[model samples]
Target: MITLTLVGIGSGNPEHLTLQAVRALNDADLILIPEKGKAKDELAQVRREICANVLTSDVHIQGFDLPIRNEAITDYDARVNDWHDRIAVIWKQQIDAHLPDGGKVAFLVWGDPSLYDSTLRIADRIQANMPLDVKVIPGITSIQTLTAAHAIPVNTINGPFVVTTGRRLRDEGLPAGIENVIVMLDGECSFTGLNPDGLHIYWTAYAGMEGEINLSGPLSEITDEIIATRKAAREDRGWVMDIYMLVRSTP
Candidate 1:
């Protein structure tokens, strides 16, 4: 039986790694790190650095080139589903090649697996071909870092918050009566599409990393600033991972 442990390493901060995550890293027979090409090679490097820092045992570490999503497909769902399928095939090949006998293998995930990440779904696809036992070790999310960096509560005393993607926010405006909205996986500045009046935005890029940048203020006042800052940061770094929270000014 293959024991697949998905360990969340949290944001870019090594200190964000939990005790359980550290233990899981040392306990794994093999760890798979995905290479996201030259543009995002630093991402794979972070995982390698994490492993080097905490791993006390002789755990085998392998880096596999990740499959790029075919942006040519106009259908969003079809494009993403096809991408996940291809990733699963690549995962299976790596696992089979490394662990022919089926031992414990771990994949270091960014943030909690239960969040927007699709590692769990890709693992599910791998299950169709092998006997696998999956485990998740939750770690800090970018949302947590974003909030903590801005020193704000995610929600009001008795209010609820909706966590969603950029595309969804752009397609459908903020949910009615939901004052708190957390946006992720947004490459575009979708918040600019919303009614800036009576809204506040706390935005952060590379939330917990060394080059972290933060902007927070009335949406109307800082929309352009955030967009320009975000653009320049991405251009300088070659890649950027960001998240933001939008809070209605009134109760």
Candidate 2:
């Protein structure tokens, strides 16, 4: 039986790691780090760095190439389903190769696994094919970090809020009956799709990492600046992870 621990490492900040997560890291016999190809190796590096700092056991670290999501497939749901299956196979292959006897294996997840992440789903797929037990160690999310950095509560007094992705916000427009929206998993500035009038935007790139950028003001005033800055930052870093919140007052 394979005991899989999906450990949340938080937003690339060692300070955000929970005590439980640290313990899980130390207890694991083998850790799998997914390489999102060479361009996104920084992600794998973060896991390596985190393990280096917190791991107390003689845990073996292994890097596996992550399956690329097929954007050219045109069918979004089918594409994702296929990708998840591919990832599950890769995980099984790595686990079988490293720990033939079945030991404590871990994966460093970005953000809390329960929130808008597919790691759990992939794990479920793995469990379907093999005898496995799964556990998750929670970590601080970019949403929490974003709100904390802005020093504001997520919602207004007696008001509703929605947490969604950039694509959802852009495609669906502002959700009904909610004045505040926290958007993540966005490569494009989904905020630009909205009517800039009467909207207050708070944007943060690399929320917990070094060289973090925070920009806020009326959407109309700072929209262009945010776009230009976001573009320049992505070009400079070759990759960028960002989240933002938009709050509109009840008029």
Candidate 3:
């Protein structure tokens, strides 16, 4: 049986590793790291650094090229499904090659797997083809890190909140009967399309990591500032991981 462990490493900081995650890293037979590209080399490096910083036992660590999603696929779900299939195949290939006898392999996931991450879903594809035992070690999510960085409670007392993606935020305005909403995967800064009145936004780039940027205030007052800051950071680093929380300022 192949033991697959998905360990959440938290936002880009090496210090984000929990004791459980450290133990899982040191216990793995093989650790797979995704090599996105030259532009996101640091993401892979951060994974390596986590191992370097916390791993005590010698573990086989390998870097694999991540399959880039085909934008030409047109259908969003289809494109994502195809991309995941490719990744699962790559993972299976790596496991077969390295662990002919069936041993434990681990992946370092950013934030908790239960959140917007697709790691768990991709792992299901591998399970379809093999006898697999999966274990998930939860770590701090970007949402938690974002709120912690801002030193604000995630929701008002006795109130409910919703978490969504930028696409939904743009397509469907804010959810009804909710005062707080979180957009986790927003490359487009969907808030720009919304009416800023009575909306307060707390946005941060690279939360819990170096070069962190925080911008918060009346959405109307700092919408342009957040956009410019996001653009500048992306240009400087070739990539940016960000999240923002929008609260209805009035009622």
Clashes of each: 0, 0, 0
How far does residue 218 in candidate 3 sit from its true spot (Å)?
A: 0.3
The sequence of per-residue lDDT tens digits that candidate 2 reaches over residues 50-87 is 88898888999999888799888899889999999999
**Lowest-sum lDDT 10-residue window in model 1:** 35-44
Question: CA RMSD for every model?
Answer: 1.2, 1.5, 1.2
lDDT of each: 0.92, 0.89, 0.92
In model 3, which runs have C-alpha deviations exceeding 4 angstroms?
Answer: none
Instruction: Kindly report which residue stretches of model 2 are placed more than 4 angstroms away from their true locations once superposed.
Output: none
Error of 3 at 76 (Å): 0.6
- Let me know the TM-score candidate 3 reaches against the reference structure: 0.97
Considering lDDT, which of the candidate structures 1 and 2 is the better prediction for this target? 1
TM-score for every candidate vs. truth?
A: 0.97, 0.96, 0.97
Candidate 2 to native Cα RMSD, angstroms? 1.5
Deviation from native of the Cα of residue 52 in model 2, angstroms = 0.7
